[model samples]
Target chain A: MNRMRIGDLTERAGVTQRTVRYYESIGLLPSGEREGNGHHYYTEETVARLQKIDQLKKVGLSLEEIRDVIELYFTDTSEVLPKRKVLGILYRHLADTDQKLEALGQFRSDLQSNIERFERWLEANERD
Target chain B: MNRMRIGDLTERAGVTQRTVRYYESIGLLPSGEREGNGHHYYTEETVARLQKIDQLKKVGLSLEEIRDVIELYFTDTSEVLPKRKVLGILYRHLADTDQKLEALGQFRSDLQSNIERFERWLEANERD
Candidate 1:
């Protein structure tokens, strides 16, 4: 298996080096290992995790929220009881997403109305 | 009409005093007047403007973006050509809003799937 450094992981993930470092600094990402020359290195899993983080960010999840979601995947699932914390995070995110959708929908509707009003005004003036 | 202080404007707009000052500093809002006592005061129109700014922000427009939108209202509309800058801002925001809606929809779908998977695992364990 090829060992990936920060540059390789960032290139493959299409994220900036600064963003990768910032994620690690914020504890959203793990700092993998140090090479012989003292340079940091990452595994393929880190690349995948970076991609996941980017996807979550596009969906408007905060870093803290993404951290909680990531915790769900690493949790041991073979146990009898499911992770209650994961469930709580998911429920909260769902409610938040719903509110965002509602706000965006209304914003879109208002935009359409304003555009129509502009068109009407233009037409009324054009007839003169 | 009576003049308004920053406190009165913030209270009417449901925004923080810090936010009002920040907006003024960023030029999204105008700093109104100095009284005999050297304290700042805002007009009724400023109160209305603050409310408009707050409404635009709720719909996800950045301060810079909101500034462009506000310019549309102030522009003289009697002229034949419409304000191109305002139109550009609105069109760009519309496209951005559509993209956000798409991403949010996808995120909601993924979240629902994860919740269902977790529930299924929980039920399977209960049956054992």
Candidate 2:
């Protein structure tokens, strides 16, 4: 696997340098390997990790929440410790997803009713 | 109708003073009526509006998005102009809610399978 510097990693991952640095600072990403030339380099794995983080963010997971489950995507699932830890995280995320699903469902219903109400009004008011 | 100050409004609405001011600034909440002693007073309706905005926020609508539909809750929906505008917003929100529901459903399935995988691993490894 080829190694890339932070600039290349961010470009490939479509994230800002600050995001990469922040993830590293917060222990969400591993510290980049220091090269002999005093430059930090990352593996292709880091690019994938950054992209995965963005995907999780879109699904409404916080950085802290992602920390609980990010390993599942990248770590060897055959490992025992992370699997147990991730099992707990997975259960928690399932509950959160259910709650979000309920709220979104309710909001969808409200939107539908409002849309129907508006359409009825327009039909009554606009003679066609 | 009894008019209350901003303090009462936020307290009843379960939001901060800054939230009230911000919503007012953004036209999500109507500006509080100016009182005789230079104090800003709001009606019961303002409290309901603030509470409604919080509900929309919980359902993941941005402030700008809320601005589009908040009036539907407060204004007379019989009016033609706002009805047309909100019809567009309601349709957009319905589409967004469907997308969210689909994504959340997918994530829920992924989590359930992961949980089951971990459970199977633990069961096999423990021999209990």
Candidate 3:
């Protein structure tokens, strides 16, 4: 299979070329091989790695944490148990996200009530 | 009516004294009167002001924007109409927050699917 260019990899991953370069610079992604034309070429695995990074980011892992996890996934001697431990981390992240969502929901409800109160005050003042 | 100390204000507001001081430093809150003993004293209006700040913050307005809004509320020549306009800005913020929440929800579902896929891979590997 032909190696994909950086642009192609970014398009396939649904992320901007800038984001791809940033990921590479931060070591969250491997640097692509440079061709004689100064263009970077990525292997098929690049897309999967990008997807994993995106998944971890969505679950609120910092780039550093995601990098550590990726390194662990690749270099760890023990695979199954380590993977299970990573799953536990993901579970905790999910729970933390749920709690944040709940807090935001409460904030939203409070704001709605405040808005209603303001409206009522406006109406009451108009009557007076 | 007797004036309250900073601690009392924070306790009543369900926020920390440090947060209150931080708010004051940022000019989102007004500095209280300094007594001879160096303690700050707050009038009942301080509680109302803190509540207003909390309400704006709940709607995700930045401290700077909240300060501008508060200044406009207090000093603007035109009152009712400007208050209505501020409410419009708040409505837009609410919509933006709702969109973010929906996007986060979609990300959560996608992560859940990825986790299941990873689990299936583990099961398949164990079988082999």
Candidate 4:
């Protein structure tokens, strides 16, 4: 079984060492075994876990929500039920993202109009 | 000239007093005149500024970016040029929001697939 240091894990995970430590501190990542020199050694499974965290973070999952999902992943409950719950959360998040997108679209439109109005004002002033 | 109290502004703006103060502290809002009791009284123009802030916040503008936009609004520069710059920033924000939406869509699809796979696994295990 291959083990990796904290720096190695962070490099492989494509996240900063501080982020990895923060995840561990916040219990997003499980604590690794410590060596005699106080260095933490993580198993290969840590890479997969970090990848999942990265994916969830990319999807805008809050750290708290990601922690809940990670807990569900580790729990002994019926896998189907937990996954269904996670899917429900994902659907809700999708709805939120859609709403945000709509809001951004509106903002973009408003900004465009403001720009055009300003252009007219400048043109009118320039003729004066 | 009509003036509004801090409480009134917060209520009308649909943001907390703390958020209003924080915005002011971050210079997103201009400092208002103080009454005899040291209470800040805002003019009607404040409402429009607050509304703009609310709209920008809805579109997920960071406080720093929002401050820049607000500053541009007040600057004596050519209105057309400033507005054009703001529009550019809005366009970039729209692109970012679109990307985030795409990522969320992918996450939702992945979660749905995970749920279905888990269901199949449960069914298979139950039959054994």
Using lDDT, give the best candidate's number: 2
TM-score ranking from best candidate downward: 2, 1, 4, 3
* Clash totals, every prediction: 0, 0, 0, 0
Better of 1 and 2 by DockQ: 2
Q: Which run of 10 residues does model 4 chain A get worst, by summed lDDT?
A: A72-81
What is the DockQ (computed on Cα atoms) for candidate 1?
0.50
For residues A40-93, what per-residue lDDT tens digits would candidate 1 score against the true structure? 888788887887777777767779889888755544544633456667778888
Ten-residue region with minimum lDDT total, candidate 3 chain A: A72-81
For model 4, what is the alpha-carbon lDDT of residue A82? 51
lDDT of 2 by residue, A19-47 (tens): 99899999999989997888889999999
Top candidate on DockQ is 2
For model 4, residues A1-128, the per-residue Cα lDDT tens digits are 46989888888878888888898899999888997889899877888888888777766667998886665445554633555565576566557666765766776666566557566766776754
User: How well does each candidate superpose onto the true structure, as a TM-score?
Assistant: 0.79, 0.80, 0.60, 0.67
lDDT of 1 by residue, B15-63 (tens): 8999888988988877778868877888777777877676666666778
Q: After superposing candidate 3, which stretches have Cα over 4 Å from the reference?
A: A1-20, A42-61, A65-81, A120-128, B1-20, B41-81, B118-128
> What digit string (tens of lDDT, one per residue) describes model 3 on residues B73-104?
34432454565776676576567667656655
Write out the backbone clash pairs for model 2. Answer: none
Worst 10 contiguous positions by lDDT, candidate 2 chain B = B77-86
Tens digits of per-residue lDDT, candidate 2, B1-128, equal 46998888778889899988887787777787785778888988887788778777777788998888877778776854666667777887888788777777877887887788889888888954
Error of 2 at A35 (Å): 3.4
DockQ of each: 0.50, 0.63, 0.22, 0.39
For model 3, how does the per-residue alpha-carbon lDDT over A4-114 read when each residue is reduced to its tens digit? 997788888899999999998998888899978888999778888888778666545679977755653344424534666666766665675676566557656755765
- Which 10 residues in a row give candidate 2 chain A its minimum summed lDDT? A79-88
True contacts kept of each: 0.46, 0.71, 0.12, 0.43
